[model samples]
Target: MSGHTTTFLDGLEALAASPLSPALEETTRLRLLDWLGCTLAGAASERARLGQMLASAGDGPAPVIGTGQTVAPLSAALLNGMASHVVELDDGHRYGITHAGGPLIAALLAMAHDPRMDQARFLKGIVLGYEAALRVAIACQPEAKLNGWHGSGVFGVIGAAMGTAVALGFDRVQLNAALAAACTSASGMVKAFGPGSELKPYNAGHPALNGLAAALAAEAGFPGPEDILDGPHGLIEMLRGSPVPPGALSVAPPYCIETVYLKPYASCRYAHAPVEAALRLKAEHGIAPADITAVQVETYGLAVHKHDHTEIDGPYSARLGIPYCVGAALALGETGMAAFSETALNDPETLRLMRATRVTEDPALSALVPAKRAAHVSLTLRNSSEVATQVDLPLGEPEVPLRAPDLRAKFADLARTAALSEARITALADAVLDPQTDPRTALSDL
Candidate 1:
């Protein structure tokens, strides 16, 4: 357990034998609900066509979410992982600066459907997976980003491995092997965040696929490096240029998923504050798109660093740009799923506002990173009037949680967008919220 990667294996293996905490279980259930909505909403996008095609063709045991198709656990995880983050509304951990749910939950649910796994095992696996992924990301952070690696794709492979291994009931040695093998399988391409080429979520799909393969291979008696995280060219040294911290692998009650933020805006997590600020200004001042002469967003490092695309030609770019999100929120009072379509990306007024908007990094905001993802927005009106606002935490953070009814409403909205019937939506909600019910059944209906 004192060994580098062995610490993660020991912590997860201990958690696997323990019963699920009631609070953590409820949080996981809600997260599963939110992840499902995002995945279904994204599944209908043209961006999801490649994964859908693969799902339709890769026939296996696990179900491929919306299309009524079944693929192998690995294939199902791959497709679901891609589709879940296509809309950029998945659950994110602020501390990790990464999304914990999309790839982790995608892999967990794929294995949970195997009938051998019960609700308890499935929930515990999710908890274990989230902890491993977030700790790895946090340990490798700032450096992982400085090295041009995407946290979710790089650390998420390890997270997916932990979850999949637990769900399959792997022993400590097998779990360690799975994680060690997954260490080399990590892929976090920062270039995928570019506008036209939509590989952001597709990069996530690789980890989900690779993780499942690692766990299965380890279970099949495959051998791998023992101290994958402590060796000379290990994850911590190679990725973060440091030794792995002992405290990162230590377990705390409630699990990491309880600390994650459920996204309200369908944009980068960094842009969420400005979007909230813009909406606040819109509500208080009734500012229309045409009435504004200039819009400027002063946010943290991750928000304004390279997210300066004022011209949004597609959904991926639209989701990544602070200008577009702030402009859309201020002008339209919301930056929900409706603001992400091809037509919405090409909207004349939206483009006009985007062109008028500028984003900059505020030192005060940057200092608040891994704590409160703060941002300040100042808007200049046609009459030369200025309005400014700052948000420390956006709508759906742990401090500012979405109400149960509102979360239900959000799920309904996404479900209706996918054209689900009223009855089906209700059934879906019931299955996810009720921990007694098997989540795979709810997914089957999706």
Candidate 2:
């Protein structure tokens, strides 16, 4: 085997042997549960509507979480993925700068419904999916944030394909074919962030569908190019504007799981630093919205792109708007799904505060892109007592994880919006904690 193949096989072997830690397992389960809840809550969205329409035209017995409709595995993956991410509340990987949870979870759930699959193998598949996705994400990190491609979809398909291949018992050659097919199918643009359109969810869903297609194609003896990543017109050469790094095509040990950052809030991870700083300012010294004279936010280059919203006016706008998030955090002490409601977006007081808040891209901060993601917040209070707080590391990072209580609280808060009963929530949590339990049962309850 070539060095690249050796690297990938080594990573796969390590992943196959790695036992799922209780904390990591629980975190994964919570993320899936949260995704299902959010999907159900946002089932009426345009993305969901489109997914339902597309699913109606497909075949099979895979379950669609919120709608409780049975469709083909590919269709279910697409629909559920779309539903989970339509509202932009799904879990994200800070280091990879992608939402791996949506596509990976969608594919896992679809496989979970398969009678031939076992829970242990299913859980392993999830870990492997995350490992592959994060590895590809980091490998392609250079173009991910800079070139406006949604890494979640671009790298997510590869993860889903790997998981699907494992679930289907594909050998090395078959896995390679599936990987190549996935690389060809991967695509998503960062423009969705700017507009916050239905395309955001589509980006999430497309990867699941693409992965399924790749695996299925590989199963049917479909041939794939051996040098997919290294080809002249391949992923790196065509889309990234740079040559693929030597040996980058191979995967390796430790995976990206070690560097993955879980999220504390449902909002964009890029907006978290400012939100954290605002919350600290409010809790530490009793800084109220009215007491704030002006707020300045300095962030990395990608942060500016992720949160920049000077022309947005709708709910989507508020979600991606750094000024809006910072303003809302300052005024309400938190930024949740409810905080992005139309009424909240149009609130005169909130708008005033948003206008007062200014965000600029600092070269020093921008220089830390894709590595040390950091943010600095400066607030000039009405009393002229200026307070500045800088968050070098946001909460939910691998080093600074949110506690179980924090995760439970966030899950409850989001679930409450969907009107899920306490009993149902507990049952879901139970299912997540027990890897032996069927995850589809937990999703079905949602």
**Model 2 C-alpha lDDT versus the unseen true structure:** 0.73
- In order, candidate lDDTs are 0.80, 0.73
* lDDT tens readout by residue for model 1, 25-109: 7777888899889888888774357554673555676776777777777888888888888888888888787887888888877
C-alpha RMSD by candidate, in order? 1.7, 2.6
Given candidate 1, what's the lDDT at residue 134?
A: 86
**Colliding residue pairs in candidate 2:** none
What 10-residue stretch in candidate 2 is worst by lDDT?
1-10
Please provide, for model 2 over 1-446, each residue's C-alpha lDDT reduced to its tens digit, 9 standing for 90 to 100.
34444466556756666777776666566565666656765564453466547546466677776565677888888887777776667767766777776787787777676665666667667777877777767667766557778888898898888887776667877887888899889888887655646467778888988987898899899978665665457666655667656667455544455456656655677888888888887788877788888988898877786576644567666767778888878876657776777677777667777888778888998787656678899899887889888887788876687666776776676666667788877766677667677675666534
Task: State residue 336's C-alpha deviation in candidate 2, in Å.
Answer: 1.4
Relative to the unseen true structure, what is the C-alpha lDDT of residue 101 in candidate 2, on a scale of 0 to 100?
69
